[model samples]
Target: MNYCVVGTNNMTASQGFYNALFAQAGLQTVLPSERMTYWIGDDFAFATAEPFDKKPATHGNGTMVGFSVGSKEEVKKLHGLALRLGGRCEGAPHQRGPKFSAYVRDLDDNKLCFSD
Candidate 1:
């Protein structure tokens, strides 16, 4: 996909968490504005934003964003970092079928998966 976005009620906390997380993951920040913060890597982009409707942002049920982060070690590292940044563990790093992956819910409870 070209891009994905997750909603956040607190832009400051979300920006801080994602800034540190993406820095280590090698995504570069781009086109930041008051309502949205974006990071781009190669052909893909990711973002966090306040809701456009002026309501509280909420995580969608059964929706998740997945990243192919290159290896098991990187998967583990990002998973740990997400937790340290106030995300909750959804699943620990492990082999899931052919891919090694880990899952976490962000500060805003958006589900994310990192895989090798």
Candidate 2:
């Protein structure tokens, strides 16, 4: 897929979370707005939006979004940056066979993984 999106209850704060989080892989915002913003990477787009019905956004129990980067060091650095930017650590950087990965929850509780 070329794009992915997750819901947010607090658009402002969630935007901040994604802004700092995606920068680790050098993604840049292609579209920015109060209700939604889309960040474009070399091969994909990622985004966040407030609920259209005005209900509080909630995380799916087992859903996750993953970003694959160029190297293990980038995975580690992004994971650390996520934590420093208010994301919660779900898993620290570690290698499992061919993949080195780290997991984190965005400011709005959306699960995400950084992998290499």
Candidate 3:
């Protein structure tokens, strides 16, 4: 997919969370507006936005965004960093099938996975 977006009720908190997370992950911010913020990497893009319908943004029950961060070490690093940045752990880093992965829920409770 070209990109994926998660909904956030609090834009300021979401932006702060993602800005620090993406900065360490090497994703660059582009095309930011008051309601939406995007981070782009070489092959993919991720974004967070306030709902366009003017209702409160809520996390989808089964939806998640995953990032392939290249190595188990990086996955672990990001998992730890995310916790330090206020994300909650869904799962700790470990090998799952052929990939090493970890899971976290952002400040808005949006799920994310980091895999290697």
Candidate 4:
């Protein structure tokens, strides 16, 4: 079945933090609302919500949402943008043999990663 994943977090900053990261990777923002936003790519789309209480669900720990890009430069660009948008660098971008990878925390402390 076709499916999409949406994550809800207590966020003071809305989904702007995620929007910036997707934008840097040249992905389009497909649907944007006051409390939620979506990033569209060929393989999948990601949605995020800004919850009123500003707390993330307890189930998200050890879970990571990964985005795949075309090049290492795109990974670096997205990682840098995430930092500028209130995301903390969990891991800096680097080569993992054939792939470049990095991890970062969104405004709500949810871990998001990228690889190329």
Candidate 5:
């Protein structure tokens, strides 16, 4: 995919949360605007922004963004980092069939998961 965009109602809080987050993963911000910020890794690029339609941004039900770190250890570290950075834990890291997974909700209530 080209990129994924998540909407934020509180830009400062959301941006701060994402800044701390992507930094831990070593993702670089490729674009920044008053209303948006984008980060790029080798595989997938994601961003957060204020909605263009002038409406309060709300989380989409049943939608989630997933990240893959290379190992279960990295998943744990990232999940911990997320919680420390104002994210709420949705699921603790664990074996899921054959993969290890963890879930969290961002400051904007966007669901995110890390897998290995």
Candidate 6:
């Protein structure tokens, strides 16, 4: 089955924060126009929309969204960029097994895992 995950937020500020995040991760943001933005990857896409009838979710509790890259260097670079873009490092870049990885939380407190 094919599936795509999209997050809903109450403000354009939240969506804009994600835009910068996906950019730092080297993913392209695809939007129908200017009202919504999506990060398209080889196997999945994450989109965000402004909340119309619902409020944004409270932060924390360990939900995560992960992405894989080509190398350990890329993982480190993306993690560093994420920090510079205002994301908090959930964990520093390191080898978890044979592969290197790291985690960070975006401005909205969504966890993102980067691995190689």
Model 1 agreement with the true structure over 10-89: per-residue lDDT tens digits: 98899899998888667888756799989988888999989899899999999999999999999999999999999999
In order, how many clashes per candidate?
A: 0, 0, 0, 2, 0, 0
How would the candidate models be sorted by TM-score, starting from the highest?
1, 3, 5, 2, 6, 4
Model 2 agreement with the true structure over 1-116: per-residue lDDT tens digits: 87888999887787777787665556778656678888886788888988778888889889999988778999999999889989899999999778999999998899999889
TM-score between model 6 and native: 0.75
lDDT of each: 0.93, 0.85, 0.91, 0.71, 0.89, 0.71
Candidate 3 backbone collisions, by pair? none
The lDDT of model 6 is: 0.71
Candidate 6, which segments miss by more than 4 Å at Cα? 1-11, 24-28, 32-35
* Worst window of 10 by summed lDDT in candidate 1: 24-33
Please identify model 4 stretches exceeding 4 Å from their true place.
1-6, 10-12, 24-35, 50-56
List clashing residue pairs in candidate 5: none
Task: Give the per-residue lDDT digits (tens) of candidate 6, residues 1-116.
Answer: 25344454544765666776566566777776454567776676776654444566555476777777779998998898889877899999999988799998876677888999
Q: How high a TM-score does candidate 3 get?
A: 0.95
TM-scores of all predicted structures? 0.95, 0.90, 0.95, 0.74, 0.92, 0.75
Point out the higher-scoring one by TM-score: 2 or 5: 5
**Colliding pairs, model 4:** 10-54, 10-55
The stretch of ten residues in a row with the least summed lDDT in candidate 6 is: 1-10
Encode model 4's per-residue lDDT on 1-116: one tens digit a residue: 14345456543464566665665455667555666666666666777765546665443778887777778988998888888887899999998878899998877677888898
Highest lDDT: which candidate?
1
lDDT-better candidate, 5 vs 6: 5
Candidate 2 versus the native: TM-score? 0.90
Distance from true position, residue 71, model 4, in Å? 0.3
Give the per-residue Cα lDDT of candidate 5 at 66. 90
